[model samples]
Target: MADYSQSPLELLLANQQKGYVGIHVEQGVPVLDRDLNLLQDLISATVRAVISRYVGNGAAAGANGFAVQALPTGQNGQDFLIAAGDAGGPGSALVGGVEVVIPAAVTYRSQPGLPALTAPTAAQPDPRTDTVYLDVSLAEVDGTVDAELNNSRDVGVQTSVRLKPVWVVRVSEGDAVPAPPSGHSFYPLASLLRPRGVATLEAAMIGDLRQRRLTVSDMERRMSLMERTLLLPAFTAPAPGQPQFVPKSGVIGQPITLNGSNFAVAPVTVRFGDLPAKIVGGASSTQVVARVPGGLTPGGVSAAVRITVSNLGGAVISDDTFTADPAPAFAEPTTQFSPGNGTPGTQVTLNGFNFNAAGTQVRFAAVAATVVGVPTATRMVVQVPAGLVPAGSTNADVKITVTNPAGSIVSDDPFRAELNIPAPTFATTPPQFFPKSGVAGQQPIILNGNNFNFAPVTVKFETFTAVIIGTPSATQISVRVPAGMTPPGTTKDLKLSVTTAGGTATSTDIFTING
Candidate 1:
């Protein structure tokens, strides 16, 4: 037998044939013939067979032997003989060859004191093999288990069977291994072995062979049980007085830390209610820093939202709900009101984002405006409420504020509020109409007043209309009385009035018209 413990180069040199191209062995009878050509062919065939077994069977064959038949000689009975001086030298001599002999078949047997039906418990490192082995039993095979069998005569043909043991290893839950299916605890060692079919023996085996098979099965079952009992990872909520989230309450987009145990050292997802929050930095087994998700309502004012963390193991929800405070933001209003000023009763339109439809209010300086109707989140219509500014003030510059339960935001610029003009009034000493008693169209009347510079002014005399003769001044206007005022010589009393953008003003004193 070759000493496999030696290095490949050393082993090859130790088995090298002398003056031949193959390995040679010395025994009672030679294990390899000395014929150079035959020896070379035998070595080549053996190597090829071993390689084929490894490739075709997916593993190296254990406890197997190869047979090499001797080559037949030619008719001259000197076919393998070489003549002197044929090659190398003329002094070369023919070397006598030994006949090869096959060794007797042997059977493996379990030695006495071998471990019974129990998994090996002692682990020892074998540096020569670079592997860890379990020391359990000392088994001697080759039918030498009993002293009486050492000298026993050869009997029936020995049958051999290969033993392929499957190994199951347990690792910590933190190890990078695919999780087994639910309710199971073991995963196959994918790098070491694969499933294959087993062939049945054609002939019946003796009592010893049957007992050996049972023993192997018992050991395999016990090893499987040990693997199945491996500890599974566990998770528990933080103990009392431990912080769950640092500074628990905050506005949206604020970063907060979540502290817990048994968190997988992998990517974890955080959710605020049904919305996913942005994770800041990274997550570890005990701490994760995350940002508060937007769209969460303020606590007390609105229902609190549940916070959850999910990882490979499973998902865990915080017992206490996360309280998100309201954050309000405002944008510029849409349309520019004509004159950029208004008083009480003026309808104003506001456009912006993040406005609360139900509890939103618009304020001018410190005074609140009357919302026309239910406001939308992005738009609202409000009326400038009374007392927004002092009664006599011409205009007031004040900040426009939008308030909601979340918070309040003020416009970057101020809005101007102008005083409303009262109805037009006649001067204390009212202007008189010239030609108090004049026939219609026969004469034109001239009226004088104050505050009449506004365009589109009109003048009326009782029920009769008048036409302005020319452009009206701030204090005076000329008009021709309508011919229909009355009959040509009829007399009647008529009230004169003037109208402008401010409003209408009538003359308290009446004038008598002559027909």
Candidate 2:
């Protein structure tokens, strides 16, 4: 059995030698930076946090270079991973704390001895495919930069390549496909249009590589980080002066450690720049842990923004600045959708490059649509939302938007989809009554209406819920009058109504009821 009382992050970090860290200062023990790093790492690994996405979806036009483009070999003399000209600026994404950087696009493979893409031969020209994917892995580095910064040659640099991402491709026939090492980010960009066609078609697999398929060890590690994010730490009372975050720099959603005196208050609010940071457990007068907020790049060497901690004790800003890099996540690729018009339940096809089904969402205006079946990086299908327009109104222009961890993007133009939703109504006033005189529960009442079968139907008598007799048709439905009505009791002027999922319609004529 485990103790449910202790904070999840605290319990995981606890050990025999170190005392509980409600407040590091109060324990008279020195605070360990390693503890902070461990807590932060676990928080970071819970999800594929995108600090910034360097490459824009092909649909997002203008300005930024590195945005995905069509690379057709039929138009080029030599094989290349992307278009030949203007390899757009550096493309970077902050995944958790690791910077998945893409510096200067890898344009041509013509540099003799460099990798080459294989073309489909006349003997076997079945359209071989070659795909371009972003692979991320942990890389080790020596202390060259560290020595330069410290003016000494003795310093250490464990993972220098961690920040410097490599651009790799395949020779289609000669070289093996480049695979991203497990435990990091791997995103698909586009497939080369081989003479040939693209080789080794890959899914738009985004997020943590280790978690593509979870195992026991993977679950344990991920659970720790997820717990920290899900659990919010309660505020300390007595109110501490403005609290400052330790390690002045961090990426968005990364756990940050705060230290201050008199951090005693019931409800506390902390902000990184202008964005609000979430409060996790381990809060005390001397220290509190918080997740970093988005917006604002590093203005100076490290400081990016001012942090303000507000509580009942009053608000105060930290003297020390907290550095946070504000990079936009990848632009979602939602370019065009076909058969523009559709009704509820109609499956509409969408075209784009690279989509993560787990992280992707589709919406028609403000209403979300169901993303059904399997979706490829380049295409997907979604059902038109029933609420595309107000009930009874025919059609509307719904702008389809796609969102993922990187960011959100809308179609270039509005998609005109139909919502031919006609409300249920009687064809005639005081519509035809079946078997005018029969026992209340014995004889059924047949209500004639339009669109009765368009949706599920139900009937109501006054304040009672009536039961339906059988299946409803496009123009009619048979329902039993409320059995509770006393026989021939002369129940006068009862309002009879027909109801569907959309709304209810009361009849202009009233029913004077008798069994």
Candidate 3:
């Protein structure tokens, strides 16, 4: 339960207003718990309603004792200041009938807001407004009970409940207090405001936690719990040999290994919520294998189910609860993909049945591909990630793996990646270069073709490097023979071109060198 409603507290008070010295004990645990609660509430309500007003140093000087302080300029921080104060207020206050007391002064230092303080922003320049309140809660304390095994001690370390007092500050974004938020309470002792991206805070902008009186009944209406629910564990922990399921969570009709007492002696029955589950063969006294019942409705939030175990001797309800998942679908292999071969960034669509509705991933070979959006049951689109295949290579075939939480589907046929980079070609006069012939170092030769994606296209004559002139366009280029080319060996033909990230493109047309 997130919080207790007031009916339980009111019942306790009404019993005492009558003539009972103490509450009656009927149901062992619950009755004793009720008596403790009644006394606790009486003390809480008395503190909140009667002694709630400040007691010590009623003068404004002492009234501001617990007033929190910080730099006038805004800054991110957890530390704040409390002056050597002279006064104190009620030690406890009742919140929704639960009494909270404070052992120290109510300040943001010792007891910061439950959710902690939030930074300010430009759009909202107001500092975080907060009110300080005394809170007293019960904490379980443990002490070793080892004195003498027979005389003073009964067990190992034993646990006892004790009241803990601390300061609690309720936070509000607005200047005025609306209502207190349960579980998620926060506050700022000093207002931290951000306007135009620069934080600006001033002393007058801060909320007067004390020394300034504010109306309480005005905002006394009960408030709901915050986004996060504050939990007080039944103050218990799970022990071994308790009923447990192997797989604690899964889709409907999934198998669960349930282990408990006395299952082999007689036919045992297991139920998830109201649906009966099938108990597999080979049952043991302490173990029973079963499957989560099918047909339970799992909606947007999923379904919560309780497992009930029954046998010839008696029926026992499981302390652990199982969450029922919605229908499950295993993705199926896709044989057909569109435009299977191309450069990276080409989007491929896979056609298949029963593709996972969400969290579906597509991988081409070892490299993972990008999924376009949420995949439907029959269709999925993905973009090939960069560098699937090297340029100038033959078409590469890569297996496609589509998967989700349910399962994976790998295609027998592979997706093909053929990089768009092609080998260089040349503009030919009949069958040779445009110029046909040139001197080793002085003549200009023009070679033009396609796939000239690289810069500084180098032209060669035999074993010598030619000097390229200006820039080389994708389809045209002009070059001169190497500077040292002499009348001897420089007068022979050789291949000319350039290599780049797109691959080496060598011109097919050979240039004739002249002496």
Candidate number achieving the greatest lDDT relative to the actual structure: 2
Query: Which consecutive 10 residues in model 3 have the weakest lDDT in total?
Result: 227-236
lDDT of 1 by residue, 1-515 (tens): 12123333333334453333464555686443224334444464455444334322111112111110111323211011111121223211100111111132211112234222111123411111111111111112333333343344555432221211221222121123444432122321111110122111111110110011112344454567545333211223556677577766776567987877645444468888888988887676777778876556522244467678876445678876677766544443434222246877888776555455357777888888888876554566778776666753456777778877777777765678765655555556644667666667644677777766565688888867788888877777888877777676578897889887678889877778777
lDDT (Cα, 0-100) at 120 in candidate 2 = 66
Candidate 2 lands at a TM-score of: 0.29
Worst 10 residues of 1 by lDDT: 201-210
lDDT of 2 by residue, 232-253 (tens): 3322232355335666676545
List RMSD in Å for every model shown.
Answer: 30.0, 28.9, 25.4
In model 1, how large is the Cα lDDT of residue 383? 83
- TM-score of each predicted structure versus truth: 0.28, 0.29, 0.26
- lDDT ranking, high to low: 2, 3, 1
lDDT of 3 at 152: 33
Per-residue alpha-carbon lDDT of model 3 for 438-483, expressed as tens digits?
6656646766676554532455555577677877777766677665
Local accuracy by lDDT, each model: 0.50, 0.54, 0.53
